[model samples]
Target: MATLNLGILAHVDAGKTSLTERLLYAAGVIDELGSVDAGSTRTDTLELERRRGITIKSAVVSFPLRGTTVNLIDTPGHPDFIAEVERVLGVLDGAVLVISAVEGVQAQTRVLARTLHRLRIPTLIFVNKVDRAGARFHELLDEVGARVSPALVPMSRVDGLGTRDAAVTERVDLLRLADHDDAVLAALVEERTPPPVRAHDDVHPVFFGSAITGAGIDALIGGIVDLLPTGRAPGRGGTVFKVDRGPAGERIAYLRMFDGVLRVRDTVGEDRVTGIRVFTDGGTQPRAELTAGQIGTVRGLGHVRIGDTIGVRDAKAQQAQFAPPSLETAVLASRRAELHAALAELAEQDPLINLRQDDERREVYVSLYGEVQKEVIQATLAEQYGLDVSFRETTTLHIERPAGAGAAVEYNKVAPNPFLATVGLRVGPGDGVSFQLAVEPGSMPAAFFVAVEQTVRETLRQGLRGWPVPDCAVTMTHSGYSARQSHAHAVFDKSMSSTAGDFRNLTPLVLMAALRDAGTVVHEPIHAFTAEVPADTVPAVLPLLARLGAIPLATGAHGIDGEIPAAKVHELRRRLPGLTRGEGVLESVFDHYAPVRGKPPVRERTGPDPLDRKEYLLRVVNRRLTPSQSST
Candidate 1:
């Protein structure tokens, strides 16, 4: 049997989840359709998700459509959890982008559309909620062409739209199809059945329906069966896209098989698959093997990770880079021991949260997308870990860039350098964290040289000014090491020979000194925005934008385009509804960062304070050694 690995994506409240449930019912996978409002949806299994009435993580289910098995992945729509959607995109054979006819195209809808297009994943557009009052199919259709993609081809039309009796008909717009392709126009002119259009990521076929009433879903199903292409596998491996815990709390990895077969007891890398589960009839069933083009859960892969290639050493999995967390908060709890470990486990599931700790402040910090996610974290900690916590004021994460070029050196037995190693380093502005060596690789033991280079990169994580220093290059200008020598006892004493530890401790002092001379500038995250408001309220919104540190470069048709500090985006969104009487809308994507205008706030030191030589010496080396003590 063939397979269609499909992704259901939409903006929040756009009814993608409803569509997933509707698909299952249509396929006879469930007895009756589940309601999103009642918190009884089949795809949404989490208690938190059921209470919130939203998808917090992506869920996978399968149902047979015609002769093909459609593995549907229902993903979160809220931008707060967009990271979930992002992980599912690259592994999908196709996608269904859901939009409500009443709401038309939204910011997140546009984002998902563009990402799908960029990844070249064939897609179909579903304009849902036609029964809802104020639903405008024609207007929304036009809006989709203007904002989302012009390659959209309407495959069906609605009758009695915006009413309970609304129905979908088998309809195709020949004129629009002709405009998209020359052969279609020629075929129409010749008075013949036009060439069939194949599904392509560049050309989307639109279907109008209401997932709630199941109106027009049959026509949409036809599109899924006919228009979308079934992918073929090349090798015997796959990429792990999503992960969930089994009933026994063991790892269940969702693998998208691009080719070949994976059977129970088969080993992927170092770990063996002890069990296999395949989705069927709306739930999972034990399967001995998973074939190509299927999404299956493999158990007992003790060391599986998202994006890891299984069975093949070189299986290609496209990595989609989504927006990094822009906000962070200090999490404080009475049970400090449990708090850190729980947060660390959560970080394992979503590494973009960038969890870190501050020993000085005795606080744990987690990166966030917005307040809703923070609330989710707080509730999860209380409910799952039984730990109550509070958060400090939310702040924007910043980065530090090298301001100039500088160099520093620490010689063996040099005063203030207690280690028996000589290391010299140079720092300069560059793209990404990079390291180069001017000294020969054979100048010292490979381990000692490696320790110096590794330490240099790690120390840069907390730069001289506290913010992480990315997009910089460092070079080992000089390197020397003491050979292992027999002292009084003829034993391998670290003091007699330079060790990797010596290089590790000494590199930070040298790197920080070089970074100090090089200088650094804090750069704030900026978001480029396109906003629309009521024409009458444009005057009121312009000054408000300025007040929030926005630079509106262009204004036309009551719309503005420019950049705003990411720190102010949340505030702008809050006031937009009231200022525009709920008619305001904005779309913001991460743009180039800019230097802050004023003094930047410093983060509490989580690592060694290399600026304070005495404190640094005590922390790194455990004690300050005098020149006499260092003498051979």
Candidate 2:
């Protein structure tokens, strides 16, 4: 049988998990639907997810829909967890964008749509919860068209049963957005377009109704089966997004196959394939072949990295550069001692974490997520690695920039020995925000050049004010090394020791925290949400939304039958339950990050402790060392 892999995405609490459950039930994969609130959802099996009632990780499940085996990946809605989404997106055939009918377009919805547009992935919009009160179908449809794309067209409409609390009684019609291709356009105008051509059009289609009522699920499922592309041919392939270690210590790499067929133990030239697994709404099952356009996990090849492509021998020829995990936070032990080795191991797993040492201060720095992820790291150490550890409060991840165009560093002599390697390197802003350090060798040995590069990378970790440096170009010229030095230990120590003085005068600036594209503010994550409440609570709820910077999109009697007012709020409101008179429920996901509004009240940091203070002074002194001008 052929396979199809797609993603289901939406804002948090937008019923994305709920809809996944309903889809599984509707397809007969599950005996009954599971509820997110009840913590019984099939995909949200993580302890953190079940406790919080939110998806923290992406999940892949397979089901038979319209004679096709569909692998659906459900992703987390929180912005903090977007890395999970980005990793999963690398391997999907297409996407199902779930937009809440009541809440409409939100900050997260906009961010995600822009990401989709950038990738040019084909999309289908599902406006869920149509049976709920105050569900604005046409107005929200217009919002989707205006904000996301001009191509979204409705596939089905809901007709009300009556003014009473009657359920959604009828589906008026199923429509498809007109195709963009000229051949189809000409055929449609001349009445020559085939029926199947009209049915499986490339235009974006929108389906509406409640996942609870099963009002329009059949048509929605039919459109997905009909429209989503299937890769039946061989030679198509994709890169692995995220890798997980199973209970038996096997590494399973989740893959999105774009253009080829993959089978268990199939060797594509040098690379070998072994353990292969496919997950379904039912459960995980072993598979022999995962052809093009399908998503699944491959195992046994422990050497594979997250972004590696599997198929042809020269896989890199067909692969695109993947942005490795950038967002990071440090997980530190309460005591300052175990910091070094702990960081080394962390770097092995996530090299992007950029773990480095502050020799002067006798401390270490590591990049990581928020407090919760930090806790996980500490726990992982104690539970898995048998190390007891406590953590400190999390801080913003910052990078360093050059104060000006470039700074020159010359390395000449070592501390105890007369050994010398003279060099000149100019450091400036490079292509991206990440700094570039180069060593143009004059007479340095190959091993010495390699050592210098590694040393420079470590020293570049934090600048004068202590922030990781960003994109800076480096040029190495006029350098000579001692033949007596056999390894990196000597060269690494000498290079870093010499560059200390120049780094001080060169002056480094801190690159402020910001999001890509949408200029960043020290924005905290907000959950765009909706709630159903008794009309009397409107007076109370209105004030709460305004206080939290949440904008209300729609509020009125939903067609779900009742006087209950369905209202939408844009930002987080933990106190919402108290304001509503036990009548309404909420749906929300992480919105975009925003600037920390207003003058952040200032606070002074207590100077480093005695040991840290002593270390800082040594760092200051080291910055003064300079090789004589005549050394070159």
Across residues 521-630, which tens digit of lDDT does each residue of candidate 2 receive? 22233334545567777778766666655667677542011111111231223465677755556544433333334642221112221113233333433443334321
TM-score of 1: 0.90
Q: What clash count goes with each model?
A: 1, 37
Model 1, residue 441: distance off in Å is 5.3
* TM-scores, each model vs. reference: 0.90, 0.66
| Over 4 Å off, model 1 | 177-195, 232-236, 260-263, 266-270, 311-318, 403-416, 420-457, 473-480, 486-490, 528-532, 553-562, 582-592, 611-613, 625-632
- For model 1, how does the per-residue alpha-carbon lDDT over 322-393 read when each residue is reduced to its tens digit? 667778899999999999988877776676777878887788899887788998899889887899999999
Count of clashes in candidate 1: 1
Cα misplacement distance, residue 428 of candidate 1 (Å)? 4.9
